[model samples]
Target: MPARVFVALMVTDSGALTAAELAQTLRVSPAAVSGAVRYLTRLHLVIREREPGSRRDIFRVRDEAWQDALANRDALLAQYSGSFAEGVSVVGRETPAGRRLTEAMEFFEFLRKELDGLMDRWRAHRDAPRPDGPPA
Candidate 1:
């Protein structure tokens, strides 16, 4: 599965893996790795690159992978909220179903608003000087 491969790659000392390496590490077929990589690449969760002077492609997680992934969710949240708002309009705002949709819309809008602040806090925490030493 793509999630499994992502976890494996995340724990690896090297941030990148070739298709063959991923297949071997995951104990899956090369086709499985290919499919997973394709999905991950499309999601911007992983990047596909060619090794210099080699035919093999390397899949790598960017240093800001988590941040990038969270950022990408903003668009999805906006879309969902918009859909819910539309549903409220169609169902009549006074109706029970419309009330539920309004609640959902409000919740997602809150998240959309708060996500950036949360990310900013995370960045500050991540970049903060540690008494233990520099981040690994």
Candidate 2:
């Protein structure tokens, strides 16, 4: 349901919707929309805000939602790397299981570092001058 709502917001011409609007557009009940929005907001996928000059809340797909989501995983990657490294020590480095854990830890650490480089490359690509010139 959250994925549905995210996609709906992405494809909307207005780029924002009220819960009632989402409910109507997706043919779902208000309760379902409520639950989906709650989950999405926690993940920073959709931002909740008030309509101009009104008290009603509006939901919109965040401009950097994908980049933000990917970037947010750094801590999680570090957590996994730490946990796996601990497991290697617990099992003794000479054992097969310890070797496996070491490999896994290294993989996650590599991902954490590569993710930083990947984001940098993405920023460079995004900011690079266009050969055809700026949009009209």
Highest lDDT scorer:
2
Model 2, span 67-122: residue lDDT tens: 88899899899999999989998998779999999999999999999999999998
Structural similarity to truth (TM-score) of each candidate: 0.94, 0.91
RMSD (Å) of each candidate, 1 decimal: 1.2, 1.6
**Would you list the C-alpha lDDT of every candidate in the order shown?**
0.90, 0.92
Per-residue error at 72 for model 1, in Å?
0.7
**What is the alpha-carbon RMSD of candidate 2 to the true structure?**
1.6
How high is the lDDT of residue 77 in model 1?
A: 99
lDDT of 1 by residue, 29-102 (tens): 98898899889887889998899899988888876888899988999999999999999999988899999999
User: What are the runs in model 1 whose C-alpha is more than 4 Å off?
Assistant: none
